[model samples]
Target: MSDLRRAAEEWLAQDPDPATRAELRDILDDDQALADRFGARLEFGTAGLRGELGAGPNRMNRVTVMRAAAGLAACLPSGGRVIVGFDARHGSRRFANDTAAVLAGAGLRPEVFADPVPTPVLAHFTRAFDDVVAGVMVTASHNPPRDNGYKVYWADGAQIVPPTDAEISAAIDRVGRVDALLLGAGWLVHDGAGLYLDAVSSLNLGTPDPGLSIVYTPLHGVGRDVLLAAFERAGFAAPAVVPEQAEPDPDFPTVAFPNPEEPGALDLALALAADRGADLVIANDPDADRCAVAVPGPEGWRVLTGDEVGGLLAEHVLRETSGDDRLVVTTIVSSSLLRSIAAAHGVRFAESLTGFKWIMKAGGPPDVAGERGGSSPHRKPDRLVFGYEEALGYSVGDDRGVPVADKDGIGAALAVAALAAEARQGGRTLLDLLDDQARRYGLHATAQLSIRVDDLSLITAAMNRLRAAPPARLGGCAVESFDDLSHGEDGLPPTDGLRFRLAGGSRVVVRPSGTEPKLKCYLEVVLPVDGDIAADRARAAADLDALRADVAATLS
Candidate 1:
């Protein structure tokens, strides 16, 4: 704590920026806030730094940003090209430009996007530039307005993984202060958003019904115009904008959390759906890399979980492809329904860590096309044919055959609405089709329990409590086996998580979110159905209830 305090003081003393100095003043005056904001140096883990925006060593300020950029530049191999992108956040655009300047000063060529763009577009562009060894995106995704992030991607257009993260972090540690370096002019800026839109347009293999009433909200981020343009270029109807969230607002006033997966983040979009009787509601986080969706349900409007949407989209992508060596990908934290769905279609299924970066790696090159040739970076199996996480990220195609491995929320939204239209033509709802999927490939029910903590130590304590004493039983079923993810028992690298297997193919996974101060418990219960759909649904629902109670009892 003293070392951290000293570091904060040193930066505070020299910070010329008025805003940084003001934030530093606040930190010095408020002991608790100081403890919270400067308790530790902001972590630059496997995914790099993301935290509340403020002016402390532990916050997302100019000092930390410059230090990180310098470290990244120093860590990169000599002669490597670096690409940068930013979202619509408080200091996102400035941070991005500053990072490029820092990189250029370090003698590395920095290719920066001209304006605020989605993280996924940066993901795609990372691979487009030859000799590019690393990529950086300034975004906080769905976090509160006061939060910002620096997501580092590797040369492969995927977020930095494993040894590279440690390597980069070590480089960052070597930098004593933010003022130690002088930056040079960055390379000529590129039209990253235009390229991203062009790529998405080329991946329109599925026929979208132009008549379907679609509503879209960028959730006050950078994706509104690009997404709308892509929809139109793909021969799909232009989406109705949720007037309140149509324009980019760093404050994100309508929602507490900008993530669409959150219960009420899509309230405005859902309300719009209710008012227009729109066929579907589509929402993207501030940067537009992740998408949130809503479908008109029997009870007002129902928001679909990321897994349900992924599984449904996976099925759609497979149906559109003709590859014999088809592979569908998702993260382990996501629902296992995709596995069963993939198996039924004779397609291979692969699981990675809970990030689109991992899924994109499993799918292959970010810029390569899938079965069909396209220039966008979102193509599925053929390139990155289809990949998603429970956190609402979906990348449709690749850039070479398609272009980049970036997630295309706009493309995914169009695909979902199109699929719903096809279902409507068949006299069925998406839920009805999902029921059919369940009946064909056993009923799959998945749920997540997330526990938020105010302190870092509390988070560690919760994980320690779980590991020191494993659960004997859950949902009335005996705990068959348990695996500590930290030990890498699942043929994957060690991660801070735990997985428990039940007696009847049921599973529970407990892990702290890498980017958020929360513990997440994922539950998957399978219901075998030979002839009964109603009974299967009832059994799955009951299983979820029991599992929820068991988790609550254990965690609480």
Candidate 2:
């Protein structure tokens, strides 16, 4: 018999978990499936373990999870306390318990969230537990139904970085087999939602406007209760929830991918908005850390891109809390309009490598101690109050004022409502305000071309091809310079990506998605708007479309 078949038979013989044994029985029937599942253990990269569920070391099954938990326990500070949280994804809760049990068996006290919740809540709890040395959140934020992930965070509440990742990986390697775990009940449960909301409330975007009407969708995940509670607590009129997606369903019945960025995912919310003439539509992915917003545009209700929403939010927040010490932070791949916007207000603008964990490196203050999250930016950036990324993650607060280092879709929605209300009070619409902002900021428009590939190697090949020989000219403009992120002085570890600057201030950035098998191309076209929103909007729209085509042609 083959080794995979032998392993499967062994698992079936010894596996006490009936469900796991049943799964193993089915996996053994298909030879190829059995091989795929049992061929090798799930490898831990800098990010941690993420794979589909099945009955092998290669899958996210009990055996694999326990092994990973054993490695984590081995790596923890000697007898250090650890906290764990899980989302509403399938098997996440079970994985959480398995992790705690494994850690407890290693003589570490593990505090777990009592129920499935959003990732941000986990992030908050990671910090709230002062005695804790590390944290784990089991979620594949915004991925499709069949997908799930495991992410590790340090005391700073950010995802694990560098030597820590390497150390944990080594320990994981030492755990050579599934049976290498000690299981026990040294696990304590806590209220993650309450703690997470308390942190979010502290970053109150002043107040929500009663005049703004909103249709919010949780996308059939765990943000329903926390988001609603946040809006209510923040003094915003309770948003009308999209009934079909108001509750947590691991199947995510309403949306195919459970990502609001996709067109079809927002259809229900958009339709509801149209029916109610609501001012805006807001959505959160399954775990709720990523947010998507739709606004009343001249072209009917439209969902804004992450860059647009992020730029507008920064602009509004800076305006509301204008101060000499204002600072705005975002990933290098995000819209450059934010730089100009920050420049306009004389606020400090800084760029971090992609990922909120990197952004969280800009940490908080000394006296305002709370949680052990990713390091803060500046001992608390003076008015260090806002950050975002193109992937729809955002943060708003002084490093020390509660833990919003992770994105909060519910919070973003409430802030947008307040901004919309203020605009309405001035007899203007969001589009009109956007036009004004763009005109002042030089009409910075951006678009992204995402290519999905089944094979991971193809993405690597594409990145290598672009890096070895980038475009000499794009969009009829000569290339002025190149920022090869793979080897640039960006003070970041080599990422496989390239950014090209065109002569006319237009730019294009190419990068592979760190967490998925996809190549991403981001393009920006700047139109100087002397006047006329309609004309400038039309010109910018055409320019963005042309840029999109240009990117597609170049990448293809």
Candidate 3:
């Protein structure tokens, strides 16, 4: 027998799932298929293990999840409790249960959620307790239906970062035969609804009056029940849910992609909003860790970009909260308008790498992040009032300044509702709030040029070309300075990206998407709004379009 066939047979021999075993048997006679299955194992990254569901280590399956769970167990001290949760996706429940069993067998207490829950609920439970050393969530977030993922969180209620990921990977490599590992069964099926719902409901900065007509959809994932409960508790009338997507459906039959940001994904919600004459539309992606908001204007209904929402939430949070230590944060690729807003409010502002792991870590427990000494280079107070990424991930910290340390779609929805209702009281719309921000902080318009690729080498070659022969000028403006982000300058962690600053605060950042196979170019142009606001808006849009074209040409 060939070596690849032998390897496949061995994997089949110990495969626990009957379906996967049959899968291996069918592919055994196909050399190319066998090679594909056994050629690689999923590598642990900052986001943890994620891939297509299949029968090999290269895929997400029982054996792979067990190995990952064992690796995580090995990194922690015995007897410490670990939390496990799953979403409504293929193999997610099984993977979560397997994680609990492995953690239990490793002599750690395991607390598994009784039902499939949103990703943020698991993060909340992990951070709310002192006994939990770590947490594992089985979800792919907004990935395709055929994919599932494992996300690891530390006791801080944030996703694992840095050396911890490296350490977990080493422990996974040290694992032996999957069939030889002992299994345990003392883990509890937990219910975190009450704890999480109450906390998130309280995030309502103010009671939303019944005048705010709202339409909501969970997009056939797990956000419906929890979001409805939170909204009702927050004193707002129950939102009209998109009936077709009100229940948890693992197949996600309605949308091509489960992410709310995808075009046409929110068609149903928008339709429902129009039918009901609703003032606002809210959507939570498959796992409910991210939120998207849509509003009606003179041009009709449109979904607000994440940066716009971030700006509105930051201004509202800082204005409503009474604290001298208020701090707000956003990713480097996000709009710098938040910095200007923070300055006007006399609050602290910091920038972190893309993910919430770095955001929460930098925002801090106060004692750990101070004076740019140990792990951080800035003075981050424990008062991280708000943090967001341009990709619809937001954390609106409560009055205590203690957010879940991760994105909370449910909480963000409530906060947005409160803010929208307040605006309506003054006969204004969400678009007006955005316009006010533009006038206050100069019109900061942004766009994106994203390129998808089937071959991974395309991305590598594109990055190399950009670095080797940089563009001198783009969009009729000279390139003032170029930054290679991998060198870890400006107190930021080294990442594979490039930034080009243009003449009038217009800039472009090119980087690979962390979860998808795409090269995303973030473009922002800041234009002064000293004259007619309408003319200024039109000029800003034109400038942004030009910048986007230049960026795309340079990258291509």
Q: For each candidate, what TM-score against the reference?
A: 0.91, 0.92, 0.96
Evaluated with TM-score, which candidate comes out highest? 3
lDDT tens digits, residues 1-556, model 3? 9998888888887778999999999988998887787888889989999999998888999999999999999999999999899999999999999998888899999999989999989999998889999999999999999999999999999999999999999999999878888889968889758888868888748758887899999999999999989988989999999999989888999999999999999999999898889999999998999999999988789899999999999898887886656778888899989889987887767788889988786643323233221223443344778999999999997568755889989889989999999999999989999989988898888888899999889999999999999899987789999999999856788999998999999888999988889999999989888868888889888988888888888877
lDDT score of residue 79 within candidate 3: 97
Off by over 4 Å in 3: 363-380
lDDT of 1 at 286: 86
Per-residue lDDT tens digits for candidate 1, residues 436-470, read 77877777788899888888788788789989999
Runs with alpha carbons beyond 4 Å of true place in candidate 1: 1-6, 26-34, 363-384, 398-403, 530-535
Error of 1 at 536 (Å): 3.3
Candidate with better lDDT, 2 vs 3:
3
Q: After superposition, how far is residue 491 of candidate 1 from its true place, in Å?
A: 1.2
Question: 1 or 3, which is superior by lDDT?
Answer: 3
Candidate 2 vs 3: which has more TM-score: 3
- Kindly report which residue pairs in candidate 3 clash with one another: none
